[model samples]
Target: MKNASFGVLLALQFLTRIPIPIAVPWTPDTRRWAVRVYPLVGLMIGSVLTLIAFAMQNVPAPITALAVLSVWVALTGGLHLDGVMDIADALGSNQPLARRWEIMKDPQIGSFAMLALVFLLAWKAVLLWALLAYQAPLWWLLIVPGLGRWAGVALLVLTPCAQQKGLAWSWQQSLSAQDVALALLPLAFIALLAPAALLMWLTVIVFVVLVRWAMMRLFNGINGDMVGATIEGGELWLLILVWSWWQFATVSPPGI
Candidate 1:
């Protein structure tokens, strides 16, 4: 139990800007357990966003959406966003595979990175505004983030690291089949909470498979940047899927 507590703390500290003053031991066991709890960290993020959404219920939807979006970015400290930019820059470079990897490593931002970031943020803000305006179920706010992080965990565990040395490689080395199985507990809990969300979860599975295939073809393997991109993309796609379901489905959203 104590080790699990430390694992959760370590996940929160590494994945978010949330202040966790506990000094977690950086051992192989702790790192493996931390990877197992990545979904929990995401659930905590979703909980914060859900609270903000409810608190601002009376406010203008656009304003509230913007506030939630801002909080989301702040909470994650732009870690995943950085990955999105790196991948964009790499893809836009149009260089050989090795050269593109070099481009991703460059600290300098390119035109493609800037454009991709703007579009991604704009889509998220607009999606949030639409969901808020439509009075969509709040459970979406709870589920998507956790699902997104779980996708990241899946990517990290299932694919080989592109880089020979880095945090992603180290994490891949530490993760075990048991850890991956344990990571699925949160998803099972989510399913029990709202079985209707199973469709959205299915969408994520397809998204991950496609992403894994594409990354393997393009980069020859996965890396931290790819994992980060997967999380951002998964969250956005899930939101879009939920909004589409709400808009066109004859039945009301689940748990409504």
Candidate 2:
């Protein structure tokens, strides 16, 4: 369990710009829980981000947004973002399936990739800005990443592999229905602890189902790129949801 936690933390520490310390001996299994501990990792990260933003009552909203984004870019090394760019580039290509794969493999950024990246960053910055500007409650901040990431992982667990071999393939093969159930059990505990977050939890559940169905239509199955897209898209929707709800919050926020 410690190994799993360490692995989760390491991946979180790798994927986000949050600073934490937990030195553990790396092992064969450490790098293999993209399907397992990603939500736990997101929970930790989102909690830290919310805390930092909430604690820094003096900071401007734009600054806070940058701080959060800076941390995210640093932590994950743009792990999923890279996939988003690659897939975007491939989709833009009016070529054969094999050609699309080749385009993804190419290091050069195509026009479509550039445009998609711009849109993604623009949405990311805008969404965070709105969240901050609305002075969104800390609870919304704390919960968004957890649900978004868990939704992504759930998709990974449910969808069949779009390909036979890749990092995603290994992660999928390592996971079973039981492993996924075990991972999600904590979500129930969380919901039981805080019923208000049920909306956030349900939002993630809905997004996961929609994303899975859409991916099935698009790729006919899921793959690394599909997973990455799911994560990115889910997060985008989560931010939108939080921002929309922030308007109706009963408690006025510090920044507002």
Candidate 3:
């Protein structure tokens, strides 16, 4: 129980800018538990966004959407966004695998990275606006973040590390199939909250598979930046799915 408590704090500290006053030791056991609780960290983030959404429920959706987007970026301190940029710069370089790694390591933002950030934030902002304006279920805001992080956990567990060092490699080393299964238990509870959410979970699984395949093809294996990109991309894709459902589907999303 103490280890699990520390693991939650470790995940929150690593994944978000939220201040966790407790000191968490860096150890193999805590790291493995941190992996197990990644989704919970995300749910914590989503809960914050949901609160913001409710607080500004009456405000103009464009303004509210931007507010939500800003909070989202601020909360994570753009950690995953950095990953998106790094991956974009690497892939856009069109170099060999080794050269791509070199490009990703470069601190300078290239044209591709700038474009990727713009498009990603733009899509997120617009989707948040649509969801708010159209009155999609607010619980989805909670679910998507957890789903995104779970996608990261899945990628970490299922893919080989691009390098034998670094945090991603360490997490991959520490995680096991049981940890992965434990991480998924939260999602099962979420499914019980909204049976319709199973569709979104299915979508996340497909996204993870495609991302894993692409990472193998492009980077030759997974890395921290790739996992971060997976989280950001997963969140965006889930947002897109919810918007599409609200816009076109005949059935109403549960709770709406």
- State how far residue 132 of model 3 sits from its true place (Å): 0.5
lDDT per model vs. reference: 0.88, 0.71, 0.90
Query: Which of 2 and 3 is ahead in TM-score?
Result: 3
- In terms of TM-score, the best-performing candidate is 3
lDDT of 1 by residue, 1-256 (tens): 7777788888999889988888998877788889888988888899999999999999999999999999999999988998999999999989999999999999999999999999999999998988888888799998888989988988889888887898899878878667866887887788898997777778998999999999999999988999999999999999899888777863553221
Candidate 1 ranges beyond 4 A from true positions: 250-256
Ranked by lDDT, top first: 3, 1, 2
**Which residue pairs collide in model 1, if any?**
none
Best by the lDDT measure: 3
Instruction: Tally clashing residue pairs in candidate 3.
Output: 0
lDDT tens digits, residue span 1-256, model 2 = 7667667766666556556776754554665553466777777767777877887657787888888877765656677787788888877776766677777778888788778878987888777876777765576666666666677677877888767877667667656666666556555666776676778777777888887886666556677776777777778887887776765663664453
Write model 3 residue lDDT over 90-193, tens digit each, in one string.
88988988999999989999999999999999999999998998877799998899999999999999999878998899877778878878998887888998
Q: Extract clashing residue pairs from model 2.
A: 14-75, 14-76, 15-75, 15-76, 16-75, 16-76, 17-71
Regions more than 4 Å wrong, model 3: 250-256
TM-score of 2: 0.81
The local lDDT score (0 to 100) that residue 211 gets in candidate 3 is: 95
Clashes of each: 0, 7, 0
